[model samples]
Target: MKLSSADIARYVASDISDGSYVNLGIGMPMLVSDYIPEEREFILHTENGMLGMGPAAAEGEEDWDIVNAGKQAVSILQGGSYFHHADSFAMIRGGHIDISILGAYEVAANGDIANWLIPGPRPPAVGGAMDLVAGAKQVWVMLSSHVSKNGEPKVVESCALPLTGVGCVNRIYSDLAIIDITADGPLVTAMMEGLKREDLQAKTGAILNFVPKCEILKSFKNEA
Candidate 1:
């Protein structure tokens, strides 16, 4: 079975190094805050002008003024503070963030990402992704599925949608696997349980290489 969105978020959270400054993009990327290990301390940043961001607030405990870039009510850590939008973008553009976790519509094997727009009725919105991709030391994408709803692969030889940032993504955390974008191409570092290397390759558009000891990803729901 494929991993759930929450499972993927937990796995992504587990992979983040301790003491890193991380910026979580809106949507599924925001869920990662809920699964970070208690022992690890991360400085979460929001483009809408908040730092030391915490997880989603409990129902009825929300502080309307405290929200993430997604505009969802969120909790703020003890040392958290707010600033102007200019200062937030300044922090982002200054390369203070270590990793940026973003959601995407398609990611190319070469590390290009296209997430802001799809070929539909909605107006295109780039948001802060362009700045994050250019500023963050590393960019990791979070996707709910490896394939589009019509069975088209999201990981491909090249992104079909308009590019957000070229050759910017460093890794991809999808429901099916964790892939690193390398000069050689997309490399599989971990895969969902019940899938084989060949099975993954069949669903991917670009060629996939795997490490000798690719780890099998399991649900973290049962972990202590």
Candidate 2:
């Protein structure tokens, strides 16, 4: 359906439940906050040790001390709280977070995730990804379908990077499509406008099984 990155972001935002505690991972996952309805209350947690994080502050409002997992400066809401790093991780490892939005390099059909590490001289950091993938009740991965800037497939049969976790992802929001990792396989729940199922599959390295008569959201249509 030729969805853009913004479409993927909107898809993830729409799935967030009111008042749910969510942890946004680095990279594309961080963009979900901008799409979330301001009126809807969602508590954001950062592993670097802040909770109840607000959206990116305006110019001159940056707080050097407060930041998200990405280490980017952030703002705190009125009811926000701060804690030690150990305690913050305890909250994550103890399963206090309702949902986690993460960026992925590859997602297996069994829901395995591998976004933290890539081979070579300068590998990507693992950071708090392992904890988030393991602890969150639902792990939503946001990524593009292709692997390279040249447009190779990233939805692989198996991840080439060091895995963050095995069978941790519950849902995936990608540029070209939205999918859910079910017991059966990767189900193509939605495709972007003008994109056909075959077209999406052709670009995907992994096998896909679409649910019969799944409702596909082509555009922003209010919170669902």
Worst 10 residues of 1 by lDDT: 116-125
TM-score of 1: 0.94
TM per candidate comes to: 0.94, 0.91
For residue 174, what is the lDDT in candidate 1? 87
Badly placed stretches (over 4 Å) of model 1 are 221-224
**Each candidate: RMSD:** 1.6, 2.7
Worst 10 residues of 2 by lDDT: 214-223
lDDT, candidate 2, 1-224, per-residue tens: 34566667777887898999999887777878888876788899988888899887677988777777777778898888999989999989998999988888788888899887778799566788899999888999888554557777778777777899999999988777778999988889877777778888888888999978656657554436
Q: How many backbone clashes does candidate 1 have?
A: 0
Q: Give a tens-digit lDDT track for model 1, residues 55-126.
A: 888999999899988898998898888999899988888988899999988999999999877778887777
Mark the regions of model 2 whose C-alpha exceeds 4 Å error after superposition: 219-224
What C-alpha lDDT do the candidate models reach, one value each? 0.91, 0.82
